[model samples]
Target: MTTQAADAAGSDKLDSGVLKVAGVVVLGAIMSILDITVVSVALPTFQRDFNATYATVAWTMTAYTLALATVIPITGWAADRFGTKRLYLLSLTLFVGGSVLCSVAWDIGPLIVFRALQGLGGGMLMPLGMTIMTRAAGPDRVGRVMAVLGVPMLLGPIGGPILGGWLIEAAGWHWIFLINLPIGVIAFVLSLRILPKDKPQPSESFDFLGMLLLSPGLALFLYGVSSVPGEGTVAAGKVLIPALIGLALLVSFVLHALRKEHALIDLGLFKNRNLTISTTTLSLFTVAFMGAMLLLPSYFLQVRGETTLHAGLLIAPQGLGAMLTMPMAGRLTDRIGPGKLVLPGIVLIALGMSAFTQVTADSSYVLLLGALFVSGLGMGMTMMPIMSAALASLTHQQVARGSTMMNIIQQTAGSIGTAVMSVILTNQVLNSPEATAYSAVTQGQVPASQVAPAVLDQGQSSLADAFGHTYTIAVVLLALCLIPAFFLPRKRIEKAPDATDEALPVAVGMH
Candidate 1:
């Protein structure tokens, strides 16, 4: 915020101008986070309308994620060099443009390409939002500001599918992308009026090599995750081998970063005791969270013989659970520290996933809802503390890299979670022995025409005995998350900036 640097210089007040800016950023954050899940409900419709395979339709989501992961490491420099306002506005423009382009796409190929562009824009919003909120509220007020920001973060994914399901059924898939236009337009216009202008300051050289290694590494890794479902064992290896290669590149990037004067992402952030532990827990949590999330819809669609809207609606309770309890969790983390609260939250998540064990062809919907709510509550309680703890550990100067690293890990884990689950679910679904044995257990009497769709849940019911298999795996993930909560300290913690850390202006990044 070098342009407004003079205005904001040396002042840590949390009143008037700063608070107003914070409100606007929150609105923008909602737009960014909500868009990620809003597309979930729309995916079924997109596949049907485009006459494409599930593999092709998935990129509408996957490409957006890949694009975001690829570009986020560079954001600190982009913000530092371009000023938050300029970069923020540009990100808004690009997102809005991508949304409009996505609405007009004639085929799966073009739509996915366009969505990646949208992700390119959307990815910057959260980090930028964090930068703005943190800088405005200052260090002392970070917890409360983050708690407020958590609303959209938790709400977007929780509500996205149901909202998109209703919208797609009522209107069409195209409207999903079209919905972004007006909101984006208003955000763009208001941004010009209110966002602080920070001029680019000359500083360290951009680490082209680190980024080069990191980007393709992430791209290939996600690509492999997406490809795993379709490529059966032989075909799966074709995709996985490249994924291994991609990881090797990331390892090379780490080595390259360790040796550099300034890396794309500063490896030094990891040396902080709390940062290391917090991020480790976060990655595990994401794997469990995302793996369960990915599994639930497949359960409904395949085993339950539900419509897309029906399947989407059934999953709403998880989000409901999260929204209901997250604020309390955030405030609790602030008051009691993350340690006391997170363990119970992880325990709740295990309970919630256990509830899934009861789900079968004839399982009660009401019971499923209860389980999801508890699961959501647990995730709600767990995610924010880990994040708050991590953020609490960082100085304003290190916040950008810290946030990117967290985001990257969460994203990567999500990709891996779904892939691993897919392998489990798919292998079971396809095996004639398991499939036939499952089919024979309860509903063996049905004719082929009477058979439920080979979707995840219906497939399970067609073979009713396999429900425990998936849930068992989910429980292991939940327990794994709980085990690490021990590393968190028991009281509200201080992030005393290290003496060795280089000092820089930790200005708010606005666009």
Candidate 2:
């Protein structure tokens, strides 16, 4: 909608300007989520194009994700120091530039380097955008604004793989990154026009020491988490050394923050009762969501013996499920409360996962689709309410720190979740590939000479059973997550009767 039309609809509802800003803000979320989702389907192309091992090629995604995670802590200060719009524009420029560089990267080394640059840029987008959009929305209307922004955050991951898979087949893997260029350009331009025109705050320092402590700590942590045992993409230095250094730096930063009169993140926020409990839940919830989401596709392709395209198609339903359900859940969070929405969402996700717990070598396609939809439905409902409740207790000033902290923990939880599940799946599948391999090998009965190199390289299982066992392991992880969902509270937040609805537009992003 045009800015004028948007203003007309909700004069005091939202800044007429924010409808436009929402597009600009959620671009970061879209970019970050899509990077991982879009590329999973293109691993085969990466293998052929860059001549990479399975472990190394996976880093293209892992490196970006870790780099993104590592840099997330810095965004609040970055925005406070640099001015959100300027930094945001710079981030978009970097992401677009990195995408172009990645498209032309001739070697795997260059590609990985280029992807890291992309991650560095992308790592800031979601949190910063969230800080901006959320601050703009203010507490009174956070529910409404989040409901709007949630569209892209939820859809991007669910859709990224499908969009990337289709585009890769139709255009090429290069198009995946290339596609971001137009989106970035539009967002950058709109940000200049629509984002809150705010001044940088006083006494800004770059916090070089904070960077020193945090980045490597996060990178190391991610490296350890991504390492999948025998399938082994674990970086020894990347996983261990940086992790040690990063941890030391982080610890030192905490000490520094404690000693200093002013620090980037006030360690004092942790003292808040509501903030503490809610943040913990956010972290755990993310671990459950991201860990399981990552496994779904691998289960389909590696264990189920489906082609990449078919696997992607089935996975799309999960996204679809999330897309349809989140809006209602967000509203429900406003109406009932976070507890009701979050707990049921978790339960539904667990139930959907439970459905998969029954998945076997002979499970029907119908059963798989139904379970994915249910799982997606559960997750869709969960994300917004949990986020809303976590931030709800914090004032606007507290939110800037609290939100970033929440993002850090939630993002970290996902990484850890995936790591935990991968360890389990990899070990179990590697050990049990025999039966599944036997079935596919006997059936394809294709001679080695006839099999494609890519097909042959996957190993052991005659493809079919390998995939079946993979799904089996994923279901186990799903079951592990179910244990936690059972304990979440059932209270829902109803809209406060005394809360004023007819005020001037809630001042979002000003915080």
Candidate 3:
């Protein structure tokens, strides 16, 4: 063959390899994301089944979130110490085992405990998957590959509730956890066959002190934030005490990281302009987006008087819009850069949130659905591109650490958003002029059916106003995210070969 023909053949082999790696990794990613959202929809069912109080049963989610936060700081070191492929498989095994236990759980306490084990596995899957894919794709193709990997993130939230509701109504709640078994098994088997072997970095040492400080710190902080929704105020002891301790420990870890040559995660990565800006943008956008997501369901179920399954279906359009735009956004990010796409995306998200601010109790379904669709489109355009740009900014050696830090920030931001929005919505509801009147109607002095029309109208309007205020806050937060997007690089930087890539087989062992 001529020289040109040889180059074309090699290029085809490279493209094929990228797709295979992305496919296997995405299966694991989908399982983790699906499990999180799916379990959420079943919380009420669990409460009834286990005969547990709301406070106790709530730990099913709280434990998982805290465990996930605690384990994330250590993933970078673990990935480097063990091989990435090996660690990825181990995470899947732990997750699958936890799911099995959860399926058979006899009570709330056992289920919560098992969910934490599941979180440990789920936590590592995301950052490790990203690190593996980033290294495999090389920086040049990071944009397109990250976009492909992002499909699970986009689809999971949209599909999880719909699927969970169907399973619970048609099959049973056990099916929610049991369903993960087959997917996890298939992903594990495929990964072992398809993933390239990564040689462990023996020179890397574990930072025991850093781990002790950071892990608990993250857990406590997330726990404190999680308490806000239940407690109704950050001033409550449950929220205040843990948050302060968590802050102190986190500060100490930062100081320790700065001093150590090889810390758990290199805080020094902040020096990279592209990475710092991208991280900030991602965190702010997540805060705004997550808060709105929490509020939307309550609006549908409580104010609009929709059923659980119906509310889940209502949210589908947003995810659909995001799914539609992501591939195009990914290509654009690679061709130009994140800057152009992310700016417009943020603006579009803000516009969508803005629409919610004007919503009334009787707003049209078509109007709300259109707004959600636009917001989803904006999310698709923004999230993966920023992720792609952040990973692209790091050298191959820095991919593991960079991926971990990004996940940590995103998780914290989500917790903060949830907590903040919960507080705001609760306060609005309590302080509304209709609160006392609504309380009287619910006190059983009169049947809801016989309550005066005026009283019913006031209650619905109050709830709608409370939700609208929460959405207004979300819009403002999303608009603020644009500031960081300005600082992202206009084009992706070409990556140089690193020592870590030396042990990998050609085309990452593609057949």
Candidate 4:
């Protein structure tokens, strides 16, 4: 082929058609991700309405997450058996229907049940969305298309609280869920109108044993991790017993998966060097990044004395920084590769996080916000580009399986990261005399004005130090991300034309 023809063939844009499919996927993902955070603001309301303790109402979030872990393992298999379009529409129906039920729930018990139902539907949406987008974009355009799909994933944490608080104050708590009605309707309509018909491959039999082992194992492990924040230690029986049992089961499943060819999740995909390296990079990055992302809002609320709404609003800069860079990162990843972008992204994140390592009681908002924006820029460049690298070289046949595995890793790693960070911060605050005193003031056990000015100042400073210590750990973890990122593809890799995916060659140089 001539030079011009080669260039023409290589340039793959996310045209109008691909954008439409992406729109549908994003809508579904927003509903799923936003629901998790939006409901977080309503926990207090549930306590008053149902006359239940915080522990009882806490199940509202736990149930949804556990349900998510359980169903995610099966999505790749279901997508293959039922077809992507059909499975996607079904997930939407289940999520929307679950939302309607949650809105009308008479008590917390019913609400928790409804949320689990919602999670079962929500869990499948993400991996399935990835499968659909990847197939639609083809291997060459995966980077740019994934960047479009990433908008909601990055913004949902910031936007959810703001949206939830406004809706609850304006229209009461029920609207938190009822709000999904309109968005779901639009997404469902768009899916029907825009998505192409499904072509399912039903020949592969289901791995029933893998399901029994892995799903329960994931749910139990996550349950224990999620409980650590409430229980305040991993040693609590409620945390340890189930977590140990879950770990054992997971080990068993790994052994089983290696022996079984069509495992519930294909462990064999790890053989792809790009996928393996990207998965490691993703695990480390998500753990550090997501753990710290939640803490930024807490710093605003706890140390700076901001309201929940203001805390969320304060975190918006990070999202804005991400938006500015994500599109450019996506296009570049397609042309160059993820490695070049991801290392710089990790360095930027660590740089931004370093600002938090020295946080004070009265750290300048401008400085902190600027730090957040820089970290956001790093995030935009990092996340989807890593995802793009993982799936970009996957064979058409392996796309669904690869997407499933990555989603599970992201979810599990995020849970572990959040739990670890929370535990460290909680311990740090307990150890700090001033921070403990500040907690009393915030909780109304001690009046702020009655406390001496020196005590108040010392307390706030101590609390900020606790946050700083916690963030120091995050920065260290972000630095660790670079080790794996260095192994990711540094230049465009040409996929081998062979149909067989077993033992794909590791391409390591510029094309």
lDDT of 1 at 456: 32
Per-model TM-score on C-alpha atoms: 0.88, 0.84, 0.94, 0.93
Tens digits of per-residue lDDT for model 4, 1-511: 3343233334576655567778889999999999988898788788888988877998999999899999999999998888888999999999999999999999999999999999999999999999988876667777888899889987698799888878887898899999889999999888888887776776489999999999999999999999998899989999998899899999999999999989999999888899999999999999998899779877887788887788788888888999999999999998899999999999988998899999998899999999989988998999999999999888877889999999999999998999999999999999988888887887556888878878888889999999999999999999999999999898885553652322111100111
Q: What is the lDDT of residue 285 in candidate 4?
A: 94
RMSD of each: 4.6, 5.2, 3.0, 4.9
- Global fold similarity of model 1 (TM-score): 0.88
Give the Cα-based TM-score of candidate 2 against the true structure: 0.84
Any runs in candidate 2 off by more than 4 Å, and if so which? 1-15, 203-206, 229-242, 433-511
Model 2 Cα shift for residue 212 (angstroms):
1.6
lDDT of 3 by residue, 1-511 (tens): 3343234233412365557788998999999998888888887788789987666888898898998998999999998888798999999999999999999998888999999999999999999989888777666667877888898997688878888889999999999999999999999989988887767777477899999999999998889989987888888999889998999999999999999999998999899878888999999988988888888877887788776688889999998998888988887787788898999889888887788998888999999999999998898899999998888767777889999999999999998998899889888888975743554454333567766778789888887888898889999898889888888777655454452332223235632
Which whole-number lDDT from 0 to 100 does residue 145 have in model 2? 62
Better of 2 and 3 by lDDT: 3
Error of 3 at 287 (Å): 0.9
RMSD, model 1, all Cα superposed? Answer: 4.6
Kindly list the per-residue Cα lDDT of model 1 for residues 298-333, writing each as its tens digit.
Answer: 677656667766777788788788877787776667
Error of 4 at 361 (Å): 1.7
Q: Estimate every model's Cα lDDT from 0 to 1.
A: 0.74, 0.67, 0.84, 0.87
Query: What's the CA error at residue 206 for candidate 4, in Å?
Result: 0.4
Supply the global lDDT for candidate 1. 0.74
lDDT of 2 by residue, 477-506 (tens): 545544544444345432223323321232
Name model 1 segments beyond 4 Å from true: 1-19, 199-202, 234-237, 432-467, 498-511
